[model samples]
Target: LNHPKLSLCPSLIMTIAFAVRWRDPELVGPARKTPRETKRLSDIEDQAGLRWHVPFVLFYRGRGGDAGADAGDPAAAVRRALGEALVPYYPLAGRLREVEGRKLVVDCTGEGVFVEADADVRLAEVEAAGLTPPFPCMDQLLFDVEGSGGVLNCPLLLVQVTRLRCGGFVFALRLNHTMCDAVGIVQFMSAVGELARGLPAPTVAPAWSRETLDARSPPRPSFPHHEYDPVPPTPFPPPGDMVMRTFTFSPADVAAIKKGLPVQRGGKKATTFEALAALIWRARTAALEIPAGEDARLVVAAGVRGVRDLGLPAGYYGNACACTCRRCPPPGPCGASR
Candidate 1:
């Protein structure tokens, strides 16, 4: 509605303008505030923002070994998992890419973002001793990588492990929020699991190409520089039964909100995304106690798929998103008809 010539515009503009909306925060995970380091989170942010791509790091807990007080040779188990994972690890295992004199590689060491410890140890003793890593899934070794500026530093996910009662290693794949959304992580992990088990993943990569997915030219930052305001930290690491949190909304509730809205007869139907986004914009403003006419933004994101689609190469890795925002202060309560 903001654009004067959107429909008549090229496919690129239509894709950029006609984003589906949802009340949920499509972009929930925030990058950790940049700690002093050689590599800055901003570099990743800028690179991803331009392309509308995000990164997702997954931690997997392997099957635990025989009864033992200490985790038995985790590095070896990790190596075996790597060997089994094969092609899924290909993107990471391949040679370094020197981009204008920078190296890009993977954590062949297997222990990424975690210190592999014996899961056999009793939790009662571990918790009573009070000497556990900040979390339980300690199988993922580390998250060190070279890019943008040597040593990418962000904890999209820090993996760890625990011994379940059934003796299966509870591999906790810590996910980095700044990289990709939960759904994206799930897709990637399922692919990895399929490969580890020697089965074909249930995915057909999307039709992707830089030419097809990238902006024809540089994208004119549609929304203002900043969209979501800095949210005060919430309960340490979102509470959940598993490693990540997933959500579902009732169809009736969604339809009720959509029914209240009026749209141009010729325009696209109001989607769940639009309804949710409009609701979030108002909620955030009200929660912060800003004036009724204040403005805010809502962002929706999707990852770019290359020729392979879901299994597309990593070069396509970057941000793909659009923001719904209040252009100027409103005279009454915040309204999308802005």
Candidate 2:
């Protein structure tokens, strides 16, 4: 085990020493024969910004003496479950292709990557400080295998299972963002878990009717989308020494902030999200100390699952969200107001 210390913050440094024994990645496909077909992605899914892979990691402690624990190989069991899960969600076990107009399509190949590895570190030791973001030794934990990170002609789903010294394990995956969003991936993982638990099929069946989200033949102009309008170039260059920090707000703190806000029309109170967004925007604007007359914009992405007009089905997994930009007047009035 190689000892390497990673500094998460000024006061926190963690030693992540783990010698990983990586096995050859194998292709896990659908358990049953699925039709080989080509399906075009929705316009939103084929966007330039969404053509990358999203990585996620989940850590599990040892199930010490649990009755439900698998006596067989856990990695093998998970691979088998993934193959079963792909039978219904076969599009994920495919490769992406781009045709004319940069439109992306899925060529159903029934190939998904599954890698197994063993780490010399203990899960308890890794969680000694705190199970938080900016994890130490992230590259080792979620190694991007060769030929698995491309946006086209690559496996849409890549999973790695790393067994730790204490019988615990780390599950990491890279999924193409254009295929599904966070909620969609969670649904797929839930289906895999259900198959692993010996279920006949997923409670919610998989759906891939992306054509429902296609744009109208003749684009109908609805509300003006000002977010897409061109903006003047910024006078200042981008900051190079940027640092990421996570802030935690308790329920009481959020409630207190909401309590200070003025009641809306019809006696409706401000929501927790609204209050926190306002508070954070004000604090950030003040900290940045931008010019008083300059406008500030806060962008938020909202899901369209609740919108009745879209007519999305229960198991439809795709990009179903849009970003809304709110333009603030100026630093002075924005920060000074309630």
Query: Pick by TM-score: which candidate is best?
Result: 2
TM for every model, in the order presented, reads 0.46, 0.88
TM-score, prediction 2: 0.88
Per-residue accuracy of model 1 over 262-286 as CA lDDT, tens digit each: 7746976788987877766665555
* Segments in model 2 whose C-alpha atoms lie over 4 Å from true places: 1-12, 65-71, 231-240, 332-338
lDDT (Cα, tens digit) per residue for candidate 2, span 1-338: 12233212222244545577777778899999998999999887877778899989999777664323564556776798999999999999999999998999999999999888777667777787556776656667666668888999999999878787777788888999999988899999999888988999999897887987888888886976656556545444357755656678999889889888887779998888889998988887677665766666677778987899889899988888887777766654344221
